[model samples]
Target: MTDTPWLTVVRGTAPLLLSIPHTGTELADLESRLSSPWTARCDTDWWIEKLYDFASGLGATVVRTGISRTVIDLNRDPSGASLYPGQTTTGLCPTETFDGDDLYRHEEDKPDAAEIEERRRTYFDPYHAALQAEIDRLRATHDRIVLYDCHSIRSVLPRLFEGTLPVFNLGTNDGRSTDPALQEKVRGILADTGVSYVVNGRFKGGWITRRYGQPDKGVHALQMELACRGYMREPGDKASPENWPSEYEAAFATPIREKLLTILQSAIAWANG
Candidate 1:
């Protein structure tokens, strides 16, 4: 059990760090203020942590949070800067889902600046603190460390992207967040899988990748964004409110999971090299 009430961490000896920041769906005290449980949590990176459950066994230190993104997005820039300047993206405390659905019951119910700061202290700060601590711990022994941030989104969100996203979206801030060879290794793995994949595409990593990634300093970070449909049954063309987040079907997820297992293993191999 962890004494850090805000975040969850699993220690490992390897130089790989697995960060699952957006999978949390809990709203805590803010649940009453939000529109409803379902809408507020609709944008969550559903079951992303579970998708990477095998990382722990591979000796990758895992850091995650239980506070919903509606409360505070752990991967967003806490300073309220947009990760994608001109594009539509959620804030540190998102008031809307990816499809422009309101999260608060009323306009005023949305978190004010002071409340946002408070939530940052309560949720955001602890998560990054734990992540940094894990990186330091892993980097102490290994010459180089890899921080792999895990994420997933609905297959189609017109508000977010033009059409359905590819199966795997790898982001490295255009190769600045990690070694170019490491990115090549991952891209090679995805190529072998023979599925639709892209690197530094729509998602070119986020705050965690940009902030903690110092490849020149022996710390590398990468973000792997998976389209939910790749591993789950994504309703229909438009994943509406009622039929949105499909349940976690282990059998349905096996194929992509195998690819991901190899990706993670390859990351560790690159770090050790």
Candidate 2:
């Protein structure tokens, strides 16, 4: 139950592990100086950790970040690689929102290479170190390890996608990052829920999933990007400070939470088999 300022590690006994990358809202000082507080909160996964806090109760280890994505996206590759090549996507450190709008008033306000690297060194590296260490530990105890990367975003961002993203956007790099059976098991669960979902669709895991999901080593990774509208009010109006408050009632979020845990448990069980 120890705490790392950037991330939280919830120790557990299950073979599965959960990585909540976008749940963080702690913006770095430099980041706060670069963008308005509103811009910083706009792209947050927005209470995803709270929504999925039941992971611990389900016997799954949880690793979460408290730092804001605007500081350095834990999900994006540190090499500045594009998760969605030939498509609009944010980087390890994004200068703009998903809607193609500048996050900072001045381009110069953005993190320079040195600053970005510094943020990586300070925030991103430690978070991944913790994640990697947890995976290694869980692998030693369990027959297999599943890294469930949790994320959420506005359902419709024209700058990021042409149309509304399915409620559950599952990504596994077209099956390269995880076992076929494991992938299918998760898809089956989401499918049965009847909550509009697509496989290897808009999001197929991020750096953490792609980098750590080694089926050969008995470590499998999966990323689930949920649309905010599935649980919140991400209206068609321009996304602003006033309309999008970062709060969600548990009663309102319970069903989506259940579906997420269902996917994790099903994946873990299938991995064990």
Candidate 3:
């Protein structure tokens, strides 16, 4: 495996840049602080890198972080404010899982304010730096560039939302992050797939999309948060560390992967048009 302790950047020639921020599982030095290393990585966007492996073939630049979000969520606000205020959400350096399970054995084991800031400097900043550089590079060539942030989550988390999530949850910061036409085109493609999907519903894009999306400036950004069940077999309600993290079977993910390939192709065409 590649020793991507921090982040990995695969440069391509297309106007689209795919950002898989939560796909990493490497905990690095933070592994020692976890009560259960497996639980700490439970919320990772598993197999996302493999699902979008075809992006390189489409000439889409890929930027991914290998460090666990338990270390520092790259999609979160650096100010530690809630992305969905008045609702359940994790933090910059999360101390609990999406299900509200404790990540550390004790409260003292969690990172302090100073440690959170240190993680931002070490992990969060570099990832964004590389993403911004890619956007700048692509923007100079194409009249319009799209930053497609890829993510996935468990289908059900009562603490986060009621009932199961849609198969594809697209967000554009409530339509402020990208042009309405671009958003409509993508939504149209998803709708044709015959899969359940929503726009700017539960997830309205994260810090990365909101911070960089400038439609008027020719840079459009959008986030796609897939429910894991769309691509893989989700664990049962009482799943444990042993039975929870399912292996990535390409055969199982083919349907969604095919749809995603079309989505990326559409995004590239839209950007160039």
Candidate 4:
């Protein structure tokens, strides 16, 4: 078995923690149970972690998991509760892809309640525990901290949203996960960039943001869901198995990186203000 750590952590003094939960692509011992490796990992946030490599230089703590979401979605609630109550959303351990593609070769290989619980104990709990530990560690020195959950998806997912998603989708759980002033600062930066963005559209912060965000107490959490086109090339139509997940190019992502840097910096300033 590979001894590589399940997650990587870079401790920083800044009052910000970048919670990147979906960029992982590892399948571990569950490879054989999956239908196709590509299909199983197709929904990953893809290089979202790399997109914010500058975060450490800014002294922002970063926590990233290497285990694939197919193993167990870390952002999901451990109780298998839906982040989106009425709308369509994947579960803690999704059985299918966003496009309704089955993740397993044999339906019988699908994880049952027992296996789901095992995966939860092995993966989900530790991730959140790591996050909380960092939060507690940072909170000791700073009066306030920001837990920024970074993510990305294809611009167009017919099954997920309507026509197309904006370049930046900031979710603060309807302003409950973060301070209103901080959200305004972020929105101002997005507006100045002239890029499309929405405050609380489809995604309104996941379990981490909702559970960790204690705006009144000091820890403010926010989820930044970026559309893939902003950083990498995406298929004009719906993504297929053939033409999807373009590599992360420095030149292509340079502009988006600049804006993201500005956003993070502004949030830090606001938090420390």
Candidate 5:
């Protein structure tokens, strides 16, 4: 067991690697810098790690970061460029929540350019390095490998997007991140479930999916951004910081979990093909 506090990596023999970047709640000393520590982590992919716990049994390697996205978003562009150019989104080190609430009490408490760069070195880099290492390790053993970037968000954040989001938002970087056939396979599975989904929709993949997904190199990457409502209770209309983020109940998520398991298994089958 490695003692690295920033992240956890579970090595598996499967050709699929699961990257759970935003599921972490640990704020370390950074929590003190937040005006609202709880809200700062309110956008976390709540219980997502546990939601996908069955991946390990399928032999899919899991690389998860324990550091909060409020500390440093491992999926954002490291150069400070926005992933969604004209749309609203957070930065490399988010200073606000998904609802556009300020995280710091004062401007002085916010991380400056120097601090952001240091965080990139400390938190962001290692997470990707581990992902890349796993990709490399798996690629050597299999003819093809899949880097499945797992994420989830609030069902509706008008500040970020209009109306509600679909249950599954698949991003293959507009078909540049993975093999076309692989994308179709996953889409086919979702179609069978009769659930709401969008391909190359609002989220067309992020840094990790865009950077490491090289189909020609035999490393296919895809990101599945699920609406939290699919697996947990997301209060409608009256959602406030205090009332939001309902507890995780396995029974409540069983239906969605079963669907997710099928999707993951499909990815593994595709990789092995």
Candidate 6:
């Protein structure tokens, strides 16, 4: 077994923790159980680690999960509760993909309750352990710590949303996760940039944000869900296994990148205040 979890930790000077839960691609033992290898990788947060790579330069700490969400969604509530109740998102150990397709080809192949728990013990637990450890470590040096949960999905997944999502989807759980002033600053930056955005619309922070965000207690949280189209050219029809990265052009992705840096910088300022 690999001694270390497939994760990359980048320490920074700012009191912010950036988490990339969906950017992982490792399937490992879970590969053989997938309904289709292609579907297993369908919901990945493509190029997110790269998109946010500039954070370290800005002195923002980064913690990324390296195992695929197919194993056990790191951002989800381990109790199997929905992040968006009555909505169409998957679970901690998803048995189905976003399109309502089976994740395992046969019922017998699907992981049982015991098996799911095993995956959690082996995968989910360790990832969060690392995340929390960092949060605790950073809290000692700063008065406040902002947990920025980063993620991205296809621009339009019929199973998840009605119309095409905006380029930037900022979620602070209806502004309860952080100070209103901080929320406004981030929103204002996006607004000034002329980028399409919505606040607390489809996604409002996930398990990490809701669980840890306590402004009065000196911890704040935010989630940024980027639309895949903003960074990569997704095929109109079906995603080919060969062209998986999908031709990400630097020109289109560069603007979003700049905005993200501004947001992170703004978040750090909020933490210091």
lDDT of each: 0.89, 0.83, 0.90, 0.90, 0.90, 0.83
How many residue-pair clashes does candidate 2 contain?
A: 1
Name the runs in model 6 displaced over 4 angstroms.
Answer: 1-5, 238-244
The residue pairs that clash in candidate 6, if any, are none
| Residues 1-273 of candidate 3: C-alpha lDDT, one tens digit per residue | 122556788989899999999987888677667988888889999999999999999999999998899989999999988889898899999999998899998888998989888889999999898988899899889989999999999898899899999999999999999999999999999999999999999999999999999999988999999999999988878447877778898999999999999889999998888
What local lDDT does model 5 show for residue 96?
88
Model 6 over residues 72-162: C-alpha lDDT tens digits? 8998999988888888888888888776778787888877899889989987888788778888888999998889999987777788899
The residue pairs that clash in candidate 3, if any, are none
What is the overall TM-score of model 1 with all chains considered together?
A: 0.97
Model 6 alpha-carbon miss at residue 2, Å: 13
Candidate with the larger lDDT of 2 and 3: 3
Q: Deviation in angstroms for 182 in model 3?
A: 0.9
* Local accuracy of candidate 5 as per-residue lDDT tens digits, 224-263: 9999899999897645767777999999999999998998
Q: Each candidate's TM vs. the true structure? A: 0.97, 0.95, 0.97, 0.97, 0.97, 0.94
lDDT of 4 by residue, 103-154 (tens): 9989899999999998888888888888998999999999999999999988
All candidates: CA RMSD in angstroms?
1.2, 1.4, 1.6, 2.0, 1.1, 2.2
lDDT accuracy of residue 240 in candidate 2: 82
Predicted structure 3: clash tally: 0
**The CA-based lDDT of model 3 is what?**
0.90
- On TM-score, the stronger of 1 and 6 is 1
Cα shift from native, residue 32, model 2 (Å)? 5.9
Which ten contiguous residues of candidate 6 have the minimum total lDDT?
A: 1-10
